[model samples]
Target: MTQDPPRLSVTSQDVANHAGVSRSTVSSILNGKDARFPQETRDRVYAAATELGYRPSHAGRALAMGKSDIALLLMPNATFGPQLQEGIDSLAGVAATHGLTLMVRFADPDADETLRAILNLRPAVVVDLGVLDQAGRELVQAAGVRLVPQVINNESNEVDLLIGRMQVAEALSNGRRRLVYASLADWRLDPVGPIRLRGAEAEAASRGVDVTHIHVPLKAAGATEALAQVTAGSAERLAVCCYNDDVAIAILAAARQLRLAVPDEISVIGVDHTAIGQLVFPRLTSIAVDFAALMEALLRELDTNGYGPPARPDLRSSVRLVAGDTT
Candidate 1:
């Protein structure tokens, strides 16, 4: 196959010659300010521009218009993860319909680097996933860009809340259910984890059942040791509520190693309702976290209300208990 040289850049002049009109008339017609031109003339200009593949230089347009009409979406950490990808998919779909372009970039929570990336963009709108630090926030504000944060839990109480409370409520509701909550130890300090633990504890106290929490350190090497500790802890009720599906699966794997049966010997539950959660044996029973709604609301906040409008959307998304074979 032969490569084609970029067609010599076609300009309004070429379009004018092809359409048999003055350059100013072509500009007026193309820019949609051609009220002075008759309908037939307008059509001719458009047809000629289309046939000649003439495109006006966007540099002039951008210079005349102060706003670039571009949005920068900032995400925390890696982009390849399933959860992040799902959010990107949802945002991209909505942005396309609105004639907006979404430029996604990973922003580190570090003080200096984070601020530089955000300030450089000067984006019209910024959607933050709580990945920015204090300095980054200041940079975003200084740029005159609106910031929209997605509050998934008690964590980073910066935006609207979407943490799953019903999951803890249900687990705590079962009077006979023995409750075991598991999560990474670092999460204990996170707004979402501790708040969720509180809900579980509150519900357990009301039911007159004791709740024991086991923390697994974030270090991968320590996971096995932590899992051993989790499974070894003696609980009468045997119902385990993990912080998320990742931890829940880890517990399940540990349980199998200990020769324990799921739901029969130990009932396991988790939050997030991720794809892997449903694929596991006994189909892990879990709380369906509404990530789609969370992302949608975050996007809407950036587009319409910006920051001061509202924390969450008027529409409410609920978390449901999926009674899988496990529990």
Candidate 2:
């Protein structure tokens, strides 16, 4: 009796044959580089692959494509926590689909070692997370490495502010009149923290409301003392607009230590929409930013601005208000 063809793994070659195309064409379409193929041909390849149960193995595909697909990210003093790692993982997954690999490297904030390292690797794409200075940019140009500065400019600067404003809007929509702004006392986020605060303040002013701004450390110990006046004095509607969920949750912990009630006495809202926020006694209301889309936009820009030190690299993030018991 005839038996099934000797058990073997499926490859792009099988898909190519089924689609009446070369393996290279199948590779290009599967890798998301579909500009070369017409709409009908692209559809045919996708259908044939699905019918043949073809799955592309990422191993060694970068070299097979004859392209320099390595991407390096140098960010000094990065937290690399779950939230940040989620963003990094999204980037790695997207890059892998495009036959590229993304590597995140930690560098010293006080020295030029990061730039020196960048020069050594000569990656096809470099994402600088506010650590690279002017000299770093110049050296990257000299080394022929694509330098992408992750700075906010006219094109995408409002996104940072949008996060804060959304937090305030959520509070206001919940019938809360009094709002407070809580920012991290970190230098690394200089203009970013101030920018978001300013946006919240501006929106509050427009609505004829007053916002109390407070800067506190990352820890939860001293937060109670710093915010005791607001927590103790007000029986009125109150909410804290924290820089991120970390700070917001810290505020919650601090309030607990002071015997202050949440939602009843105060409501807390933060950005980042971290997963930890969900586990708290009262789920946190947060401004969720689409980090995957943000990275996708920046990476696509590399094709256009790949030659010189990267442009401001229009960084955009889609913000959404996630409702929870906190608000």
Candidate 3:
């Protein structure tokens, strides 16, 4: 059997013909400038466009409106973990409801080159998750593209602090007094590790609990060395709040090699609540961030900054503790 040719994309002209309106009318109605037109005409245009699966070309819109309906998500130069993936997926869904196309790009260290290429697309907004540098900000501002979370201040650190607080709270609930913050050895992979450490320290301090800090690499040897440091110079039971599930798992394995009883001698809590955390020998207690709620807060922030449409003001705390065998 012969394969059939691909169906051509439906265009504005097709929608206009189907709706019994001129191309200009279809364009105006689809672009949300339908107030001058009759409600019936607007309904017809929308219904026809939907029926024909018509998608307006971003290039055409950019030419006409000076900016495409693209929301560029600038990701940090780090490992893409489950939390980041889930956040991206959630943002894409949220952005679509605002008639925006979501595009993700790993933020390159070469701010000039990265911004130069991003500005070429003429994105309506560039959303950064705590990665854009001073140079990148200047470039995006010069290009006149709206950047979300405009201030680029310490507000983003609140999320990391929340994670830290949740982890420490869960560890304390398990009756582990000696608290320790386990950060990743690679600084580039953990830009917010220090903020998280601070949060843990603050929380622990409030309860009159002192927390030691240790850096653990992903490798077995590094984890073993870190575990040694964690257990050194103390006989009291310890609780470790890890940067992520991977780091927590590494510690779990190191504990097994050291023959340390989890939650008895060393309670572990992690972030991201990854699936593998549940699959491990002793299920890893982790922090689960409500990415949908987080994205909604972000969208609302953008709206408040006059970058997008108004969103519901139902922002809630996104951090929660997932109970498991480890804690």
Evaluate all candidate structures by whole-model CA lDDT and list the values in order. Answer: 0.63, 0.71, 0.79
Off by over 4 Å in 3: 1-56, 302-316
**Sequence-dependent TM-score of model 1:** 0.67
lDDT of 3 by residue, 1-327 (tens): 975442346777889899998876776677665677899999999999888878778887788778897888887777545776677776766565565768888767776667777878899888877677777787787777877766665665688877777778888985747888898887464577878898898888888899889988999988999989768787888899998898999999889888889979989998888889989979889988777677667765555557445554433367778889998
Clashes of each: 2, 0, 0
Better of 1 and 3 by lDDT: 3
**Number of the candidate with higher TM-score, 1 or 3:** 3
Alpha-carbon lDDT of model 1: 0.63
After superposition, candidate 1 runs with Cα above 4 Å error: 1-67, 78-84, 133-135, 150-164, 184-195, 198-202, 205-211, 217-224, 231-235, 302-318
Pairs of residues at least 3 apart in sequence or in different chains that clash in candidate 1? 155-192, 178-237
